[model samples]
Target: MPDYSFLNLSPAEFEVLTRDLLQKELGLHLESFTSGRDGGIDLRHSRSRKREVIVQCKRYTGFASLKANLEQEVEKVKKLKPERYIICTSVGLTPGQKNQLLTLFNPFILAPGDIFGRDDLNNLLSKFPEVERSHFKLWLSSTEILQRILHSKIYNQSAFEEEKIKETVRLFVSNDSFGDGLKLIERHRYLLISGSPGIGKTTLARVISYHYLANGYEDFIFLSGSIDEAYSLYNADRKQLFLFDDFLGKTFLHLKLGRNEDERIIRFIERIAKSDNKLLILTTREYILAQARLSYEVFEKPAIRLANCILDLEGYTKQVRSKILYNHIFFSNLDQAYIENLLEKSSYQRIIAHKNYSPRIIETVLENISTIRPEEFVSKFIGYLDYQDSIWKHVYESQITPFSQLILANLLTAGTPIAMNDLELLIRAFAERFASKYGIVYSQIAFNKAITELENTFIRSSRDSKDKLVIDYANPSIQDFLVTYLNDLQDMMGDVIDTACFFNQLVSFFAYEGPGTPSQRPRRTHLAVTPYLATKLVNRLTQNFVELPSSTLKKRLNSNTEPYYYQVRRSVYNKLNFLRHSNLYTNNIAMRNFTLEFFKLIMIPNHVQSEDIGHYVSLVIYFHNEIPFEEEKILAALAPNIETLSDYHDFKQLEALYTETYAKFISKSAAYKEAVRQMVDWEAENVDTLDIRDFVDDIHAIVDHTKIDLANVIIDLEEKFQERDRDYDPDEIYDHDEDVRSEYRAEEENISDMFDSLK
Candidate 1:
């Protein structure tokens, strides 16, 4: 049972609920409206044609103070002279207070049992379930909540107009085969409804659920918690309708579940696919449904997936949109007099025909029109919806609390759904650090309260496949709102570096040593951020590269450890890939330079995994193409380690470029050739003592020597050659040519060995 103590209702709302209860339960005709005073009575009713009853509602909390309020109402009762008077209070009076009230009023005028309090109201509401739904709707599950919403004061049986929907649905045969879809559901026992938000998908699902409930379905189960919980709730022996809202994925934000939940869902589907009595109805946003198919491969299979039962509600005609808008507005709680006046205005036609109009937009405009004059509401609302910035600003300012703002900043900075517990930690840490900056001390209780508030509006929390609660911004629109809002705040405060570092710290959890043994250690409980999301966070954070501190960038580039070696390197590689594929930054010099520096920091001196060699080489290629000043240094550092290249396929491109560039540079350098010749002559003279490896090392060292000295060394070698030639006999000259050829071939073999070692 829900705790009634947690039920918070304002005075006017409580009175309205009381009036609804009285009207529904007592069969009373209310003669007075909720607002204006009718001789200080809240409601007037007549039991018989001649007998009048007066009701006064006081939502007082203090029992001691009830007598004072009662005395004031007692005076109004005496003046009205009703046959019966009833006083209603949210808090029941104490026994002494009640006895005191009874004694003050004349026994003939007021009876002892006429005073109704909270307990009495609860009993009345228990008797009228429909009234409870109509008045108090916030604290209920899905089907009940939707039932109350659909049958609200603005929308009721007469206002539903299913026939109009049916007529409109027929126009888009390919869009919504409503009859065929239902027929497929009957055959398959599973129906997946996919559509854009506010496109009548949930409304249609609710309509179907209502139909099944009307047809004697025993239960309406809204999915939450685990699939095991869902399985326990399902009864094959009874007729049941399971409403899985946003079944394919999250409606407001994108989140990836762990493999366990997907497998559970697949198993659930397998069971439901063969069921006869159990029916499952699922609704999801269109793109999310597609993503689900990718996430769960079984969803793509024809036999297990129930592919034929899928319905896409697209291709909505203008006439249908207008009808949908009209139905929502007609039954909405807008002021009837203002609605009537606006219906006559030509400006109203513009609202109906406006290209930007949507049911959600219209509903938002009509939700609270009491603050604005009815005559001007529609016109002003239409103008408001036309401006996207205005809507974003209004939504951001309206829903964002300070704690929630910090949450948004972190999520936006993280650019992924953070685990709920981890997110709370982030918020708490951020609050502690920026306490003086924000001018508020935050506690855990405050953080929890703020999170709950966010969940009701902009933030959404759901269990992933791992059964861990993860939180995300409700949708792409919310993300957009936060990005713009927080970017401005970050600019003014210059805290992007701080935010980036916080997320970076969280991501370092990915590098945790290991899960270890179960006997020695408990399971690791923390958010597991995907590599894809990590890449996204890095990309987003770097968008403010100019503002990022050098120290922060240095930390970002520190990916040399074993745990984060691949993850950070991949993040940088992915960013470069994005730049390569995208046109947004054709010549982003700062990003290019920053990424080059990052590559320099992450480059491996030894062998990388064969699988990752391609990614490593890609980073090298990016340096060669983008960072001219560092290209030669990067290649030279990598050149000595070419033997570490595990796969030729991974290094084929790099090999070709390195070879072509080295060959071209060598051919252009006469000084380099002279240096090589002198090194060969010196090795020939020292042939008996010199090792081939040592000789090759000396040749490499000479390549870096000055040109003038290399020429002098060559001249000295030529003089030695001339002196040797003069001392030799004519016959010995031929013998000398053969010896020189032998030495030259030996040196050539040694040079090839040096090149082979590099390979």
Candidate 2:
């Protein structure tokens, strides 16, 4: 039996739970009354034309409080003179206390069973488990479940706090998505939840994860980094559930996915699909997913298409929207005056029925209610709903201080999940450069004060897998707000660029116009750079590239660690790609000279790895007409690394260059053909260890390029599939179709009555 503390629910939720349980226990469809001034009636069912059975529900934690509240209700009950009166209280009542209550109501009480207390409610829940499950908040908030959820190893991600999880469960109103998500995950062993911003994609993912956790899953793994992290942490014997929130980069695709990341993610999904003990849940903005599919051909696979669960506002029915609003208001810390104002005139209907109704907007407004003047609360609240885009704008402009705002600006410019130390360095750098313009004094004390104010509001500080303190926006909306804010204030772009601690920040702010770039805006918000701003940005990049910091150079030379190496490599790649794709490099002669000089300085043959070789080849190919580099040196770099070119993507790039560009000078060489044959042979030998999904395309490419026969490898893959099919069991799978349909029907029937009780 689940030990549920009804105290976790608001009085309104408690009332609804009581009504549902009693309706099940007594076989009567009771009509519920509005919460305030009930006139001695909470719920009533007509037994005949002349009389009705009446129920009075009091949600109190103590017997004394329950008795005192019921004493005031006695006279109202007497005047109505119902056929039978039943009293229900959350406070546990002893036999003596029940008798004492029976004396006060006399004939109205009729029997001790008529006075239902806390224990009786629990007993009813045990008997009617369906009712217990229907009230998600009631069971999810149980102390045992919350303890289990919080104690899971996955909570180290810092996004999942104890109070936050509890509050999320309390306020979450189930909709069709919950059931749909369950069926999808159960059937596919993976789910990709996509939706518009603020439509509760992450919330739905967390809810589904919690459901599996409460069932029998051993761990809830949060994939905070690349899909490789999932592969690293996967335990074949353990029933581990994994979540990758905003799997496609949150702000932009370039920042999120690296070379072949799309392929890597698809392969990881296939791996999860084959595993019986694993479940993967991913969430991304709908536009981001669309952009990914357009940018990366690998994402267009049928598996990815089947795994998508798109959450739309249409899925939120009027009743579902009402319950969402009612839950937020009921659990909110708003003063009674504000609550009354919302309840007055059924004003909540306007909000629910508004064109721009969003759960995020509602949560943001309610969260900052203390900042709004009581007199203007109603108008301002409705105003925010009217202008949904301005919800964060209002908060950013009015609620936060200018110092905190600067902190957010620099944090945004610096990019997300930046080290706390690095952000402090950038903040101090910004203050040193432009403190007087913003009318603020710069000090360690001031910086600390600003960060303290913004924590969990504008920004959140969390330790990553490495246990390094890093900061990211509290939510994506903050990043969204900051991007729009910064772009509109182009005057600050120069200052932002000048004060940036690293060159990558400058690159993140602008998108270049070229083929293969997203037709839609990049997820990473980019500023609309004018010609003047573009020139200024180009100059900064040139200066940074030409005069590489001595300390950074020393680190690059001294450290061989993968992280440091990759950091430098990624920064260099972003700069080169920006120049190659953007007009900044094409139109500016001086910028081109500086870029070539920088390339000569860093693109050493011995230092270049196989993974990075393609970057150099693509860069050289793009600038083949303008810049001159030795063909012999390029071939020299390619020859020794031929055997290491194992990734199919590398071969695809070479093939493209060979088939359609000036780079055939390198790709049509003896060394290139030998490299292709070696890679195909290596794969054929190690086929059993490789994922078939990854190698299937590779095999096709091999057959096209080298006419390599892989009959034995294909036979091996077929046998593996046959073995998997033989082991499959329909009885082992849990079907949520019936449960979901029942839950929807129950919610649909009760939602109207539940909101009516709030009037």
Candidate 3:
């Protein structure tokens, strides 16, 4: 029942923290966010001049809940200028949400999900060769019997706010970068630092109190007692901002707040509000809880006048962790090839091991580094964090395909309605592999302490239980899997393939599992576009449409990104290489003009009405992106046999065709012009929004000059038909108001005869 820590790192403190994260944790460099104008872009960690990175820290309590808001805010900052954005929250993303979130934000990151698909368990084997797959799962799931243990403390904001920050001030002091103390206050304001238990709180608070007392602001006073005593201290010649270390009520009567001496505090703030020159600084765990209750009376004024600007200080992220661990800007003795290889091998097991890479925790891990190898150190770390037993471990190790009734194949894979046998088999394999690869292993009774974990992580009741193990990945284990595995896998494989494959496969098999592929459908799988999938799908589709080569894929994926994810059309052919070669574009070897092609990755799988809303938007956008030109022009130029917009048949024929065309071919039509304009406008607005790549299951006709011309072919045909009817049936009544007169046959005949005689 105490505040977590006051051992919060000040901005000056982050200098050392950044160096620690970069050098020890990541093979990166620490570029401070000295420019406060940069939203939350705290630092850049790059291995080489060519490789750039942007580190964003969201030091929030419920960090996951805040991703959407921060993502939007930071993205705006990214677009204000060209800069990489690797936005990280000190409060780590929920496990399962990781992949979904990453896929959703792929364009904004340096890499797509291609490199980090959690499914790529092969990478894990390579990274942690010593980890026996079977024992790992058990140990990870059951801490009592397992050799090691992990405990994901699902932070209750309410409980956190109750304790307040008056307790652990020293730990915060330990990491405080400012040595002399008083000058340290110059860097971070509104400094809100948070972390796990035992990290540091009261210690840092004491240190901060000492700091302000030693500084010029000696008039300030600290108060943490009953309401009357607290209010009396409020009578001092306080600075413009009064620092309230414990805003939560210390007495039962003061709990609800806004009364008694707290009233006096409110009146004081009212006077300050009138001046527009007052500030109120306060701290409390009560501020961390759900509906974080900060009574207006806690401050010498109304709540808004004091704590309106909320900064949820979280534990440390990798950047800060690295700084605390290593004493340098970037990795000193750390090996880049090693980490990348490990990432490629373990596919991000290290990230999982370094789960709570908070400054406090990372410091703990590093302090004991000599006790363990990097892999062992990480394994031990994750085992104890309660973020282990990831569902990714389930998917990667088990044969998800066998569960016919509840079968879990790549949702994009070809499959039929599952039978019970299939579902059972699927779960069985899931269990087996889940235990073998990721289960915790040890010779002790660690499992007994982890009954909760089994219910939370394993899903099954026991080791041999066969009940369905489907879980809402939001649980720490499931979420951890998503973050650690799925996201990692997605980054491992190309986005076009990963996003489209998994989401589409799921869309196809589970809901509409009965339907077969459309006649002549492309070999590729369908993709899903929750708002999370929007921007990423766009990037993949953009590359495919622009005809980026496979070889250049890695280079593009590794580019440092800011919060700004790519819009389908903006970065479609826009990304340029150092030599100005674009991954999505190629030199026209034959025609000698630049061209964009292979834009299929962006296609949505199903046109189902009930599919992902983002996908539907993507389908519509794809239509909007098309240019109107006749099929003949396209044929003559790139001469794609692919379907054009003329009729349903031509459109249908384009299903499997991978074709290319010059801009000239599609630039001729007014309709094409409109579609392109609308698409650009839409991309401008929604690029970073969700659902740029919609893989429709129904049918997707490539948008081209001919296609734009064809979308309205029926209108043209009907017009021609009306013209023919009017010319042939002159006697027929039409919508026109004009009258028709009949001719006299006898008069015309006589005139002809007379003319002949005269001749």
**Can you rank all candidates by TM-score, best first?**
2, 1, 3
Measured with C-alpha atoms, the lDDT of residue 73 in candidate 1 is: 65
Residues 1-759, model 2: lDDT tens digits:
555658767666677889999999999999876565778888899868458899998878898888888889888987899988999888888999999999999988889998888889999999999898878778777877777877666722546777888888888877787877777787678888887778788888888888788777887877654665676566667988999998775434334465566777888887777667789998887777777777777877775564354445346788778878888876675677776677666677788888777889889888888788766766777898777657778877887788888888777665776667777887888889898998878888988888888888888876533445667678876776677777777777778777777765665546533333332244345655556676777777776763422111101111221121113434464367556654445455556677776776655445455665667677766656665656555555555465443433543454443454325544456665566567656765554333544565666756665554565655766676566557666565544355444333324434434544553
Model 3 spans with C-alpha error above 4 angstroms: 1-215, 225-230, 234-243, 249-280, 286-303, 315-318, 325-356, 363-376, 387-759
Considering lDDT, where higher is better, how would the candidates rank from best to worst?
2, 1, 3
Among residues 3 or more apart in sequence or in different chains, the pairs in candidate 2 whose N, CA or C atoms overlap within 3 Å are 251-523, 251-524, 252-523, 252-524
The better candidate by lDDT, 2 or 3, is 2
Q: What is candidate 3's local distance difference test score?
A: 0.32
- What lDDT score belongs to each candidate, Candidate 1 first? 0.51, 0.70, 0.32
Candidate 1's displacement at residue 576, Å, is 19
TM-scores, one per candidate: 0.41, 0.84, 0.23
Q: In candidate 1, where is summed lDDT lowest over 10 consecutive residues?
A: 740-749
Residue runs of model 1 more than 4 Å from their true location after superposition: 1-181, 224-238, 251-257, 260-267, 290-299, 303-307, 317-320, 336-341, 344-348, 354-356, 368-376, 383-392, 398-403, 411-423, 435-455, 459-759
Scored by lDDT, the top model is 2
